[model samples]
Target: MLHQSRQSITCELDAGNSNCLTITACYAANLNTERSDLWVDLINVQQQLSLDSSPWVVGGDFNQISHFSEHSLPSVNCYDSPMSEFRDTLSHLGIFDLRFTRPLHTWSNKCPSSRIAKKLDRILVNQPWVSSFPHSQATFLPPDISDHAPAILNLAVNLPTSGTKPFKFFNYLTKHPLFYQTVLQAWHQSGSIAWDLSHLCVKLKKIKSDIKKLNRENFSDIQERVRVANRLLNDAQVLALTHPTQENFLKEKELHDKWEFLRTIEESYFRQRSRINWLREGDHNTTFFHRLMQVRNSYNSIRSFTLSTGEVVTDPVVMGVIAISHFQQLLAPQTTLTSPCSLAWFQALSPFRCPESNAQAMILLPSDEEIERMLFKLNANKTSGPDSLTSELLKAAWNFLGAEALPWEYRSKDIWIQLKQVSEHTGSLL
Candidate 1:
């Protein structure tokens, strides 16, 4: 161990280009014990973190759980304040509980009838550490030296090498207050265009370039600012609790608000990366999202594939072309037969539900009330589009953009849509 204290031992090891600081500590051997002092110190270190502090790898027999689910068949009586504090401490410090391969209790009370099991030991890491070593795994070994199972963190695992990744619009980028302004700045730099469609295409291209430059300037490493903010917030909170001075109160509020803002950014980053559409907001699922991304990356990866002519191809460009060609061929348009079948026969095959009453009926455009309902019904946490626009943003900016939704239309499939006629006004710049 590199550093040790009364309750914990810390060992910092260089992993890849960054360093990992592993902290292990034991609260107590018995079921219930007072260890708030130990937790306070850990939080203290987490709060006073420097700009260049190593990625944290904290784990041990914490002897508590933030939520009852970590313990076996828990109920109301199993609640503990210190355990809550422990959970909060990890969360406030931006640490995550690394899940084991198999779900099992780390410590079991050796009795048969009254046997009790709990997951008291866990290995956790910050966002920076997990991002650096995405393939890191944690395993639970059988109890030997003590009653608790040894939690082993294998941090040096390497993921299979793949080619350049595709560009994906991150939902979190939209959370920043300047996100919309940045897009406008990029679009404005594209210069004036005479035609609407051509202007749109050019503006979009310029916007992408501007966004890239903005990202490079603002977010080289995603969690660098977040860690610093968390540390400052921790210090401010501790001071507020201990002293409760007026100046400290204002400082705590500022830090708290800033931390929350950064936290939402972090959450959006994970959500987009996870690609899980049904997930809700305000849940502690950063690690879950990280794992989901890993699984998705593995599942969607094409290491190598053989063509129909038995030619094995491993080049990413070749693989992409082959896959694209295969799909394009399948979807390639065939000449429509002048008369594949009688019109009566095709009409008879079409699905109809009360056609006489519903098919001919037409509903007008939605009103303000209907539009409001539609906006509220959307899942705000779902992924955003390439423009970094999301349902949540649209809802928030409804005052400005709500009326513009009149031009947008939603089409439902019945048999085939037939737009009989359309009209447009033509105009030119002076």
Candidate 2:
């Protein structure tokens, strides 16, 4: 079985480099032999090919014919089994047998009386190597002295000569100074820091008022205008080409730059408001929120929280109480009986639910009293003795006081099977 599986050394030509890769098997066999040695030789050849980094082509007596039809002469012991196995082996290795056009017979009978001729000798190449040189041709050269004729192969080689283009950054901006000046002027005219800050706050308040107004006004139009302007400005810097001297290009640059500046201001204002709204909504579970929480926790824990700027802070709670009192003074005039409290004040006092939800769904806010009650209930339920008040409070806060949950629903077997299949196909963990 080992002898039956070995393959012979093969030579391959790289059509791209005219480089030749040659490999040979450990064993050799004659035409009249059992061909078990040829099999072993072929297997070894395959193993060698796998180890080889260079392209390869193999050609030799092969001892076995590739096709039954290649053996035209009548022989009493002719068998198709060897030919079929050879063809299968070639197919399995992804090797292609070269087609011969002239003097097709690769082997001839040594004896004059037998007059047998067979195309047993063949040339093969790795399929990928052949694709680069599709014009390759194989032919049998006339025998000089031996009965076997030498196979001749010819192919063309084409090599790459040049590298790809390099990248340029300055090509993104317009060459004209007037257009450039317009963009700069727009940026400058945007407003001073103090003016912009005040304007940003005012715009944010207006946006909130617009949203709260029960009238059927389409704020989406204003939002879209702001969005479109910002997009134009963001892309203008990328679209402006500095090399060209076309009038149309300058006009386009000027138009886009103006629009971009307008959009940028609007976007900046909207972003500031969005951040304030996000804080007010207590959407602080994200990384930014956690970072702020860490800072606050550190401040609360440390009695002396000093700054790197040589400012010493003594009695942090006293300062915090003072700040809260100042904030309350400012908030009272704006605060309505139904208005939601700021996140800082809301969290600082006992947690109180704001009646800001629609009639369909109610938002739950747990009070400090309710938190204490839940903590007591959780402590009573504990089987172990004497759990700390902090531990009990934490457990209650995480469970009942955090958020609402829906009742459990069972899925059908088919749905579960489909879900599992989808998860497996998409490589999803859930």
The top-ranked prediction according to lDDT is 1
What lDDT does each candidate get? Answer: 0.61, 0.45
TM-score of each: 0.48, 0.31
lDDT of 2 by residue, 1-430 (tens): 1122334434443334565554342223665354665655565666855723334566677777776557756552455776777777776666656544445677888778867778777777654344434445565777889888886776641221234422211111222234334333433344332122223223222322222231123223444664676576555544555434466467567767766544443343233322322343223223343333333332233333234564544554555665567678986555557867798985788765556565334434445556545545542212222211122223322332122111111122343554443332211111
lDDT of 1 at 233: 97
Query: Candidate 1, residues 109-196: lDDT per residue as tens digits?
Result: 8878977888878877766555556567676887986788987777654443457653444545565678777765554566663133
| Per-candidate clash tally | 0, 20
What are the root-mean-square deviations of the candidates from the true structure over C-alphas?
Answer: 13.3, 32.4
**Model 1: residue 221 alpha-carbon error in angstroms:** 2.9
